[model samples]
Target: MDLIIIAQAVGLFTVTNIDDIVVLALFFAQGAGERGTTAKIVAGQYLGFTAILAATLAATFGAGFLPEAVRAYFGLLPLLLGLRAAWKMWRGDDDDDAPGSNNGPALLTVATVTFANGGDNIGIYVPVFITVDHTGLAVYTAVFLLLVGVLCAVGRFLATRAPIARALSRWGHVLLPAVLIVLGIVILIEGGAFAL
Candidate 1:
């Protein structure tokens, strides 16, 4: 491992995922005190990041020709999810959709949000992925996954704190759906996914 290149990759990945720390914390807070909460959030993070790596690898390699329109359409996953959450909330049906509930955004919803959030990551990771050869990419991916675990641990720790956990517990329901909706719309517009 060239120390300098590894350092650069670490720096770039950390900078790109800075927001994820907060996002992950919020997710942890969502299921705070619930059994297996941390596990679910970590699983979702891994799932989402895997999708990102796949997309980056695909784009960096010969499979880089996906149309912008089609890419934007990817926003649909998160958008529909957010809408469903809002609908459930509005209908007072959120009991079944609560964080620990079967209908709530679980591993897959979190993965969608992570993937949708990672649209910009492709732009960043593609160049990095291309610049690095197979070996370097593999090493970077390994480090990235390890760092993701660390990130989730930190997020879970912070979420377990009394103050933050309470606030998130009170407001997470009101905020999560709205956040997902706006996040999806931003992804759509940013990616130029709209037909217009």
Candidate 2:
């Protein structure tokens, strides 16, 4: 495996998912005293992230057969998602869809939230994955999944610590929407959506 590919995978995954730490921490905190909650969270994270990567890989392959003009439209999904997130933020609406401490299956609830929150991830990843070869994509996927485990550990740790959790919560909620909006713009420009 190339070191450059590894480095790129690490950097890209970290930048795209730094906000997840706060989310996972909060989830962990909510399920702190419950048995099997940690396992459900970890499994759910993997399940959701795997689905995102699967979609990204499919889009990367599909993009090869599509015309540039059509491909440019791919940016719309993230742009709309970002706009929706910003609107919610402005309205001071909590993520009402978030998984709660209900008797329902925690894994499914967490997976749903993870997948919903990953719309921007698909937008960003498809472009990058399109640029990489098969080996590079495999490496990126492997690295990403590994980092998910690390993220879970970190989130669990943060749940046990109040200060860091609070600090991250203060910023993560505000930062992700902005990042999504910027990423949507960047993806659009890169794909020449505006030019089209």
Candidate 3:
């Protein structure tokens, strides 16, 4: 259990940040305006996360999957996705739908964004699971879910403040993708795909 908690904490902490903020923005823009909406979104996020983690664990233990080269390739996924998002933002494309807008805050939307945003995390966890015990995977998943909910609540509270939210929204667009790129690079280096 302790191992699980540690893995969950590490994985959750690794991915929880501006990336999540962008995802949350999608939900908020979609009209998740009710007071209870954030909680529901968080719950939905966890469901998606758990599903991904389960799959990752299965692949790790059952198939001995995720070779180092494969991990490096997966590490680049976030870089590509983040760069695409940044390009869209730079091009002033606002046509992207918020999660709650079309589906009315359905669990599916939450799952979608969770899976999407969790792509890099999944890549990271592949290696983690290769080394860590299966129980650690569960702990990592639970802790990540708990922390994400808290972070979303806090972010919602902050975004409700007009000026701060606007400032965060502006900077978040620029910073989030940059951070993801850096994380991808780091992972690649760790996987020995990059020299420095």
Model 3 stretches with alpha carbons more than 4 Å out: 1-8, 15-18, 64-105, 164-196
In order, how many clashes per candidate? 0, 0, 3
**1 or 2, which is superior by lDDT?**
1
Q: By descending lDDT, how would the candidates be arranged? A: 1, 2, 3
Two-way TM-score contest, 1 vs 3, winner: 1
Best by lDDT: 1
lDDT per residue for candidate 1 within 70-155, as digits (tens), equals 66766777677767877776777745434324333477767777887877787778878788888888888887888888888888
User: Candidate 3's residue-wise lDDT over 112-194, tens digit each?
Assistant: 54654554565666776677665666666667667767766765666667775566445655654565566557656666777
TM-score of each model, paired residue for residue: 0.87, 0.65, 0.56
Kindly report the root-mean-square deviation of model 1 from the true structure over all alpha carbons: 2.4
**lDDT of candidate 2 over 1-196, digit per residue (tens):** 5799999999999998887776677667656666788998899888978877877787788844444455445555545655775686677765633233222126865564465456467768888888888899989999999999998999899877877656545554455445445655765776677884
- Kindly give the stretch of ten consecutive residues in candidate 3 with the minimal lDDT sum: 95-104
